[model samples]
Target: MVAFTNFAIAALAGYAAAHPGEKHDAHKMKRELVARDNAAQLGARSLASCSNSASSQALKARSIKRRANAVKNIRQKRGIKAPARKDKRTLEDLQKWEAVNHNMSGTYNYDMFTSIEEVFSGNTSCILAPEITNGPYYVVGEKMRSNVKEALYCDGIDLFLEVQYIDTNTCEPIPAVAVDIWNCNATGTYSGIATEGNYATGGYNSTYLRGIQLTDGDGVVSFETIFPGHYGGRAVHTHLLSHNNAQVMPNGTISVWNSPVSHIGQLFWPEDLRAEVEATYPYNTNTVALTTNDEDMWSILSADASFDPIPQWVYLGDDISDGLFAWIQIGINGSADYTEDEYYGVAAYLDAEGGHSTGYTIGGGGNGTGNGTTPSGTPSGSLSSALPSSSSA
Candidate 1:
């Protein structure tokens, strides 16, 4: 029931009049549809290509970022310096320097022995007394006037020694150095079995006389023991010295063992003490204690002067009834300055018995009278003598 407009009615009437009963062009319609589809496919392919290009560019950017990060890390590590490593080396150097110097640097006075060769050559001028051996008949008794409560009927005065060394510049202590000591007991008996004995018998184990004590860091050492006894043919006396070894070289440098000897000489006791000790010995049966200055051994030698008796500077003090104690200070060169040449030489002489000389004794008893057994159960005479060289090195 709808009525057509004039335009629509006219168009339909015109189309029907112009081509009445004409067939449509189906081939042309199909060609036009196929062309339009091809254009649409081309546009889609262009868009797909653009998307793939953008993805590739993004991946390249990520790769560049990773490379930049890696470079930055490398630069940072290389630029940094390790201060801790340098500091560790510096600390090690400082420690080595301290050990070498021992803090000494200056001129110091010390006693030098000129006749060391003569002393070791069996020269009797330095010998206080000839070595003695027999003492079975010597009398042992208590004297009311004796200084010590316990007294042994012997020929020598008992001597106790303490030796030490110090750095003059810093006043620091020295270690592992050597010390040599020699003394006569109340009746003129040597500490070692260098002679004979009546009661105790002279021996290395006999504590009555003879000892060596090394100093500690404080530069102090104390020997709590008896004064030496005297024997016939020698006067009351004591001798001591500090010693060290050095290395020798065939050429270039001369090195000292960095060890120095100081304060060498003998010590004399009061006349009263000498008289009391000498009054009870077998040597007293024939002779008396000679004046220290008058004795041939002490007279020919001045303290640190002549070869006789090797005069030692003594630090005299109150008499010890229980034991005689003595000490001395020595100056030594630290190890740092030592060279191979200076470090290879022997510092002291060997005893007549072929032992490294530390001291000497005239007579009292033979070796092995006292505690002849060592802690290791070896005989004291046969035990190894491996004491340290210096108090400090």
Candidate 2:
């Protein structure tokens, strides 16, 4: 009886030791399963949040696109035709009407109209010239001649131009014209600002870095300046092209003078620069950044079909350290007679680094008031009074 009792006790102890390890393993596995489930729930929630934000952004973009399309339709309904070439005239002939009118008035506030030196501060000095060309190539001549320069800054970039040509019919290119370029410094602040009866003066008294150049035969123009910085509410861009002209005849005969024909437009940076700029502000909130080759409000409205894939007439190059340089082409059509083909006018091209390029229409032949006004509230007919022409290369 004693030996039987001993054997029973020993067997019970052995079994107890072996089962404890198995129980511990089961507890560990249960904890792991609970952790995994929690992680999955968190991941799903994050994904849902991202999806909602993207949907909201897409809706906003679609709304803007619809509005732009509506504007295009309205212009078409107005019987606006594209511009084409007709006659040619000398600079004196083009200026004849202005000489006679002498009463011709334009915006001349210290804020809007300043000298070239005031526009380009902290940059080098340079000059751009214009030449003449033929066919679609004439657009290049216009751009090459315009002494407009693009500057990049922290707040935003500025494009300074003396002149630009906008076809009244199709809102396309008008060649063989000069444009003056100028803008604020790197901080997106313009020159000649007055505060508390004290004027804020920095660079040249006459709009710094501002200069004029004529369009080439191919309707191209060029400029010398620095890379502009990005500002709030807009991407990195420039302000340029205040005055532009359109030729009605090939022999320099009948010409339409659109003085102070404000052409306000801007150039955007590449994806890399855009990303950096958006990180700054209001732009950061924009979800469109996710998409490649995104277009802004101005781009969709002013872009032309011919400017696609980059215009051959446009060119861009720079020393990087010293300063930047750019060239654009403008083509003017519809001098002799307005035709459907001529109504569309010509396309301008731009060439920049990284193979990035874009184009916009030149001559939209519509007689409308531009944005610039004199200090006395008199409207200026200068091309600079409206949206300036733009190119990205």
Candidate 3:
């Protein structure tokens, strides 16, 4: 009842401030997620306590070097002269050079590339509680892989994503945690489910733009993907789910049936970046009306002083078309568990035959006992039986 009320309020608010082509309806209500409902549901060390720690300093230095090297590589590839290196760099100088050479006007501020204080400090302090509904399109037991981009029917600027997980209770990195991420392609359609408005090349059998990766010793996981496109009534975003003690099946999917979900949240990009990217090909071709961050209820509610859900990013080269490198720290309650969450009832889990279906119509609804079959009408055999699971450790 409370969730419905929140949805009602958000829907009303969204209607009052609808954008030029946005339609507020049942589809809009699906995004009414309130992740931050109470204090116990959140945890993260105060910035002042660890902002200057040795670990943080090392992280900041490594991040800076990684971005600088990326920029240098792009320049080298394009036959552009490399900028002179400096022992100490200033934001003003960086911005001037980027503006003159990269045409970064109307895009994200140059400071976001250099002054990544938010990235270094990390916003992982705000853990997403289990009670919050995962996004409407979330599928369990996705393939375990770093490259989520299948390029089947999607095209846009490349996005190399790196995510670091931190335990809120100890303010320390938590390695070996399974992180699941999925998003729509440049045309605003998701894979792994038979949904309306999806591309002909996408459906229950397709796994594009959806995959999982385990964090390394540093609690980091990287992905090669394309920037996500927007849909009606929602801002551009990516959905994420974290699992603790989840095992990998023989067919390379996660064992979500028994694993406890530790966190469920969405990551957002700066509007400036989104606007510039959307102006490009394929993305600009999307017919859905653009939804700004301020107008989206999730974006509005996710904003708080303790954490910044947006990732810190850098352009791969002098132009937005060259692609991007983005990173963020996500905070999670390492001990919390939501194995019985109601949202899991509709998950399209994996079968031994490499099929994913829950007998439900996916984006639509029905009884959960239909014959398991791929979108191509191939019988997937009986439901998946328990299989051996793998671990990062």
- Say which candidate scores most in lDDT: 3
**Which candidate would rank higher by TM-score, 1 or 3?**
3
Candidate 3, poorest ten consecutive residues by summed lDDT: 95-104
Give lDDT tens digits, candidate 3, residues 310-384.
Answer: 675656555677777777777667787654444323335554455355443312343332222223352543333
lDDT of each: 0.30, 0.27, 0.57
Assess the local accuracy of residue 287 in candidate 2 as a C-alpha lDDT between 0 and 100: 42
Winner on lDDT between 1 and 3 is 3
Q: Flag the better candidate by TM-score, 2 or 3.
A: 3
Clashes of each: 82, 152, 2
Model 2 lDDT, full chain set: 0.27
Q: Which ten residues in a row have the lowest lDDT in candidate 2?
A: 125-134
Error of 1 at 326 (Å): 5.0
lDDT of 3: 0.57
Name the candidate that leads on TM-score. 3
lDDT, candidate 1, 1-393, per-residue tens: 012234423333332211111122333323332442343243333333442355434533432343233223322444422111100011232212111111010111112212222211111112111111111111111111112213453333333344344432233345533433444444454433332332235343233333333344444444433455554433455544333332222432112233443333354443344455456445365443353333323222222111122221111211222222233333332332211211111211212233222221112112322211122332343222322123211
